[model samples]
Target chain A: MHYPNGKKNDQTQKTLANVSKSHAFSNRGMTLEEDINAANAFYRDTGKASIHKKPTPIQVVNVHYPKRSAAVITEGYFKQPSTTDYNGIYHGRHIDFEAKETKNKTRFPLANIHEHQIRHMKSIINHGGICFLIIRFSAHGETFYMPAETLFRYWDDQINGGKKSIRYETIANEGHIVPFHYQARVHYLAIIDKLYF
Target chain B: MHYPNGKKNDQTQKTLANVSKSHAFSNRGMTLEEDINAANAFYRDTGKASIHKKPTPIQVVNVHYPKRSAAVITEGYFKQPSTTDYNGIYHGRHIDFEAKETKNKTRFPLANIHEHQIRHMKSIINHGGICFLIIRFSAHGETFYMPAETLFRYWDDQINGGKKSIRYETIANEGHIVPFHYQARVHYLAIIDKLYF
Candidate 1:
């Protein structure tokens, strides 16, 4: 996506906004990230939640001063995040979670998550924050909210030579479904309200 | 600081750690950011807090895939942060704050913060989270914690043609002093304990 002359500013953000807007009428074509971003925007506008996705961490190697006012990163690489991507306050509770979309129909692979991320989620739960995972099954067009405590059991079992994936039936039985809405999109907060608040 | 050939990893983070280590013997040479980062690390290690400094946001304009596994950002620019730099859970409560250092002797300029950032801080406070500003006066070798409510009064005054900066004397009177320590360099949670829980 090359920026036009004099339009180099906010190309990344604009690209995301454009993607979200292009599929505004229906969410069938939108990615999970786009839907959550749109949902977060709606939550912010309605003063229901103040969540935000942290910017992707990057490590810059060399920078070039093309002009006095512009410093361009000539070489950089993405860094693995040490914590969950999205977090903020909700009704006085610290809300933290990671969201992922999978096309797998039968089971969700634990390989989709990193070990450190599981540790971070455990820490958030121990600290009494509302922590969970938002898993979107693209094949079924369904999103489910699995509490950190529930996920920890499977994670611990996986560490002890058990199955490497959680069956979709287990997730459906243990996790609450996140209904889609026109404005809220993913509508995970509705599940949070039922589970925690 | 340029990395040696084939040693390009976490250059920015290493630069900060190098700065922190070079000034380890004394607090005199440490920047506010370095000190706060040190404090946050100590807090995390001790399990007293789970705070983290949000990564610097960047607008990636272009990337080059020289190899299949690694993608390098070829052109990117810095993006202004939408909220405070640091936030996490503390003692089962949400904590959010921004830290700034000013070399000015008498006044801390309000221009150091953006208007939207102020609005974000206010929203955090309204949501029942603990939100404040950590201001470092290098000339005085002191840091003050100003609550969002206290800062809002001055912000409103600035909107009505008041002074563009807060006087050092006024800050000293209105804000709590953050003590410096060996391990917890900034020692802000102590002030938080005194004011809140």
Candidate 2:
């Protein structure tokens, strides 16, 4: 099967295998999403934060119901999300962010983010909520928490005919490296504490 | 066609007509969802607030892509949401809420809300985010904004073998009535301002 993006199922399987082989997934090779979910779960359990990954929005077209089972949606299409993936309350402040992973070793491409996502981030920042992006460089086995403000600068630079991608060195300097913990796998909130608080 | 809930599409149409006839829908008989969407749009346009109703979550089981056009989800199921419907940043505070409507005249049934939703509201409150419910009594032409704290009391009462429904009188006494506005539509934020700010 091929996705709308033209990526075949086998391609996705190969990518997953590559991720497991290249990245430091030591504990049964967990995906980036799994790590974040684990971290969020830890946060929720410990009263540290209350963040949740919003479910992928799908526009359902047709549904079929069996007499004795749950209703099944037979036709639908994936909808482009209007906002960031994760958002919630943190220290009485609205926390909004998007997380993305790239396998590139030298740079992170800005094209990985959608235009509407950038607009959404801007809106959050304007509303006085803390907004940021969590970027994972799988090739280097590193993750960084980059504030929305820094991201905006890069975004504007691109619009003004600058580099299309952010260099690894730039991210290293401007973004806070998120440490991976056993329990709190992606410890991005620790960076938020130091940066925002 | 009849939905799994046994409500025919025509019955829904009749209910909508009844809603327009009995309740306040000054603008060409808009539904409660439409009113809230309008309010949110106005809030966004005017920089008054940043709130959005999360899309209904659907779990896709199968998909098919034609030679051209968008990919179609062939099989799916409506997933129960883990959190409230509407959530965003208001005055730098995390704002979370669920909006519901009932055609019943005397009482609001507790069954209108899921148990997980009650738990989710509690978590939001514990995390210091402002949470509430926007309920529309279609039979009475009334709408009210009830705080999560007030909702928790009733929810807990039901769990303790108390009343399964909250009397309309209780809602009128404890909740703030949401006034209708020309541009702002539902104007629930006005109540939020008085209660929280």
Candidate 3:
């Protein structure tokens, strides 16, 4: 960020307001999650897709129910998610995918993705659900939709002592680029339309 | 019933531990959630389907990341889920549902089903996803599968000066019973198979 994380952000926001909304959005430095959430909201509002992000899995060990207020989780631990973070029905097909952002422009390290998650994605694909990954290269501001099949290849190669990451060039050539827009920051359904519909 | 307080609690915990290890679907007193989870586990293990219960939505306010342990959610509140609790794919179709158990023998109350959840179900059905509710009458020990389409009729009726609950007899007559099995305790997919496949 050009300025400190404070009133400077709002000050710059106003200056950027004079520019295009999309241009402002990129300069504002919204995370990939924020962009995808905005895209999901747009898709939902337009009746294009019924996609949603599944809640972070938390194992609640204890809860305190106050007299009139909501129940408060006193002791809880985040659990490893067995499935991808997002899924829904799109065009009568079961759509499932996990999204991640990497600052490294050279490659995406596979350490963040767990083995059980890979198994879950494989199961989804085996059951005829559409599964993929949305990888955003933060340094390059490029997001690519890599199918689970393609990811499995790299994952298996990694398991067998291959390179630990998927090269950015390989993804750029093999994966579909998710377009960005003012309303849908990551208009990924456009890529899905071309690939599936 | 005759045991003392502390001993009874320990015995109960031990019984639960044993029940979990042994696939004892014949065992009594399993909650609707446990039954549904067992059914989902069976489905996943057998490669029959890939359904899963979505994690309870929690709004985490504060977290404590200790030096050696995993992050602990120190302050969090339960969130009202906009969508149903469980959803996945079966037979190449998206399956979405909310499951509940009622001890009341006369009827199932409408207070628990939120308006937004009903709207989400409608959208899921509109998008060609298989949507439904799994209602279990704990007193009667009978579980029924009620389609979202049918549930909407009752929901709309209740919205417009109708009864606040669905009569148990009405459900027994119109809804499909979800058979209990040794492995898949709920065995709800059986009803889906008969209805769709």
Candidate that would win on lDDT? 1
lDDT on C-alpha atoms for all candidate structures: 0.86, 0.84, 0.85
Please state the error at residue B176 of candidate 2 in Å: 0.7
Ten-residue segment with the worst summed lDDT in candidate 2 chain B? B1-10
- Give me the runs in candidate 2 sitting further than 4 Å from their true place: A1-28, B1-28
- Arrange candidates by DockQ, descending: 1, 2, 3
Q: iRMS of each prediction in angstroms?
A: 3.2, 6.5, 8.7
The per-residue C-alpha lDDT of model 2 at residue B164 equals: 95
Clashing pairs in 2: A73-B76
The segments of candidate 3 whose C-alpha lies over 4 angstroms from its true place after superposition are A1-28, B1-27
Q: Between candidates 1 and 2, name the one with more favorable TM-score.
A: 1
Task: Judging by TM-score against the true structure, name the best candidate.
Answer: 1
lDDT of 3 by residue, B27-133 (tens): 37687889999999999999999999999887665577777657777766677887999999998999999998887888999887999999999999989999999
Clashes found in each candidate (C-alpha, N, C closer than 3 A): 0, 1, 0
DockQ scores of the candidates: 0.55, 0.39, 0.39
User: TM-score, chain B only, every model?
Assistant: 0.88, 0.86, 0.86
Identify the CAPRI category of the predicted complex in candidate 2: acceptable
Q: Model 3 over residues A1-197: C-alpha lDDT tens digits?
A: 22324654565455445433443233347877778889998888888889999998886656777775567777666878888999999999999999998878799999969999999999999999999999988788788999999999999999999989999999999999998889999999998899899
User: Per-residue lDDT tens digits of candidate 1, residues A34-99?
Assistant: 788899989988888889999999876677766436777788878889899999989999999999
